[model samples]
Target: MSWANILKQYEQEFKEAEVNSYTELPDGKYTVKVETARLKESKNQGIPMLAWEFVVVDGEYEGRHEWKYSLIMPERMQWLKQDLFSAGLELEELHRLEEELPSLLDRLLEIKIETKMSKNGKEYRNVYIQKVVDRTPSQKPENPFSPNNPFADDGKPINISDDDLPF
Candidate 1:
């Protein structure tokens, strides 16, 4: 189909679809689940770093995501160790992070997030994992971000067939 025809067909959806934009969360404690984790090289220095994307599991901001990055350096190990331990992944060797990173996914924890503005007028967030929360496998949601989810972005209920019900 031509671009014009395609746009015409989806014009209503384009207007109604919500834009997924980035907005800093307010400074407060939040219960989040680790959605993704990886070890990557830092942009500038090429230093190894553990990067994480955490999804808010509940509350007013449920389904919202925030990123946390920890550089693997001697000076930064203290804080990294503390955060990892809080997430229930205690490690004696830092090199073991790669093997353990995948385990962080689906782990639930209480995180304290704070937004700070630098002198240059840029804003950044600090994510601190306060503690790991107990979550049985039965309580886990399949995929909160999936389009077929029965809950809308605002947490309102969406129409679904009886087959969609877990029970």
Candidate 2:
């Protein structure tokens, strides 16, 4: 294929792409899937850190990306452990966690995003891993009020008169 033909393939995407891809997403909770996670040096002082990339799984902002960086140090171990465990990863050693980082990719997770202003008056977004979201098919009914639900609160079927509803 010629250079002109290769560029034409991405013509639609180029038109739709944002002017800058670094813009931060708004603060809110989101369901996302881990797209990338790896150990890398911090930009400021070259300290070791784990960097992550997550893409919103579904919602108005679907496909929007966010990042979370966890500094690898003794003091940060508690929070780091919480985040890792929330993503369904538990390890006895940090090295083992690093080795198993790949397992986090493609896992569904609930994340909370907050925007904060720094002392320098610059705003930044903080992403927290709230919990792992199970997307697998389960035996439980998706709707609690659906008829004949085996896991209903009572053995009897739920029946309600129109007058019972507040409307």
Candidate 3:
């Protein structure tokens, strides 16, 4: 689709009935709430997505919408988390199915909404109606005690005594 139409469509979907609020993202780690959706082809099975939708809920571009990402369900969302972080968002700020996403998505699957954005390159959004599966990380068994240094477990932080030195 043409960028003109694409932009216009997003403008409508994200329109706040004609109101916009902006906030500056301070320089630091942050969590920006996002709304996501996914879509798939009617004829394809177990096939990768046709696209996805992602919406920003805060900051300068609050209410901005994207509908051209490649994310079809039933699919995993770990990568989505990564991409969101890359796009200046964190899971700390999320609303799933419009009901607070981070926790909700961790517990159940929600149908998401997304829109396609490009003709050639891959750029899309998880429309508000896309599907999201439980994406919480599993808790690993804790060791009896903390190691001296995590890096030392890999030997990088290990000290080399005089004889151990590879000089």
Candidate 4:
């Protein structure tokens, strides 16, 4: 098909209504689920760190995400240990961190998130997982990204096949 003809056919489809982007949640204590947790290197300090992405599961900012990073090296182990303890993991040894941290994904916890201004006077937010909450006997945790999950509505997981692409 000619480029002009293709463009003409899809012109109306491309003019669909605009969707609003997610805004930062207000600074407060909220219940959140661990959306993603992984070990990553710090770009500035060149140290290994545990990076976590948490999603609010309730209230007005239900689907918003917040990030938290805990440095895992010897010099920063104290803070790292505290964060782990707050997340319901009590570890006295550094070696066990790597083996157990990944299991925290999808776990729900109450967290205190605060917004603060940096040295440059720009505002940003930080999340601190305060405590891990236990699920009721009849309830089970669900993945927000799963097809059947209730929170997956606005942020639906798209599955695009290779053949569906134009190029």
Candidate 5:
């Protein structure tokens, strides 16, 4: 209630805050969930743009966020359309697409992100949506009894010779 108490509480909150750095993750294909998709005016150019925020759903970078922006310019329209398509929308018109942009939120998309150093010498990651797919786990099933199993050949069991056996 007092100002001193408020300051102490704020300090405690800051002490408990988790620190996450902006280190660029390795360039790779990742399955991401669309956390946000919205149209906004660019700060410098005052041009309308579509901004997307995605969170990596799998891999070591899971929970890390990546962003993609598409300026609403004539030359960039095709790219915007492709981005929307990759987010699971197939509308052909920009106006219609804009109206449907909110639907992209929470969609699962496969994206290829590349890492590069910026002019300021800071590493950054760029998100490029490759396609939309079901939110399935990235792991493949293992078949221990199959011929292609690493421990045995097809139609054969792992052989344990007496000489090679570990006693």
Candidate 6:
């Protein structure tokens, strides 16, 4: 149930069903300000590639106003090209979408984590959802978001799109 696990173990396999099917950024995407984004470049069985990231969109963030950017494997421009075309978007628009990607992409996975041991085994870190729960609150109101907030934790599960939510 931790993002650390998912990133360390299942990222590649899980991506097959996701990256292929999902090739565009949504209209209103965003990421938190405090959190930073990272990128990794690699050769996929001799194929060059890159990973663009917009980090920390699922926590008590800086109000969805920022996003980190990276161009992993620029050698593999096809991925980015296809994604932009699908969305009818441009490269700069990718950053705009990055800010909102975590929330939108969240709907595609359940809990967004797959636990696994790290190269130097010690403690398990979250790699998918990163942190499922954000204990700290950057912005708090006089009245806490009780059972009436849009994201209120009601007894029954809230309805979301199966196409975009977690497993």
Candidate 5 wrongly placed segments (more than 4 Å): 1-20, 116-125, 135-167
lDDT assessment of candidate 4: 0.81
Q: List per-prediction Cα lDDT, in the order shown.
A: 0.84, 0.84, 0.42, 0.81, 0.81, 0.38
lDDT tens digits, residue span 1-167, model 6: 78897687877687676544532223232332233332344444443332333343454432333222223346635655554333233455444545543333322111132345778886442322222233232444533334455465674445557786577
- Candidate 1's C-alpha runs over 4 A off are 1-21, 117-123, 135-167
Could you tell me the lDDT of residue 145 within candidate 1?
52
Residues 55-85 of candidate 1 have per-residue lDDT tens digits of 9989999999988998889899898899889
Candidate 2 Cα lDDT to native: 0.84
Candidate 6 lDDT for residue 21: 52
TM-score of 3: 0.24
TM-score of 6: 0.21
- How does each model score on TM-score? 0.67, 0.64, 0.24, 0.67, 0.63, 0.21
Report how far residue 19 has shifted in candidate 4, in Å: 2.9
- TM-score of candidate 5 against the unseen true structure: 0.63
C-alpha-based local distance difference test score of model 5: 0.81
Clash totals for all candidate models: 0, 0, 39, 0, 1, 23
- Pick the winner on TM-score between candidates 1 and 3: 1
Query: Which model is ahead, 1 or 6, in terms of TM-score?
Result: 1
Q: Which ranges of candidate 2 are over 4 A from the true structure? A: 1-22, 118-122, 135-167
Q: What is the C-alpha lDDT profile of model 5 across 35-152, one tens digit per residue?
A: 8888899999899999888899888889988888988998888888888777778886677766787777777899998888999999776778898876343346667656666767
**Candidate 2 C-alpha lDDT tens digits along 24-132:** 7788899998889999999889989889999998999999988899998889989888888888888887878767987787888999999889999998777899988
lDDT over C-alpha atoms for residue 136 of model 2: 44
Cα lDDT tens digits for candidate 3, 1-167:
98998788678567667665653322222122334434344455555443434444445654554444544343546655554444333457434322322332212223334345688977554423233333443345544233445445653445557996588
Which has the higher TM-score value, candidate number 5 or candidate number 6?
5
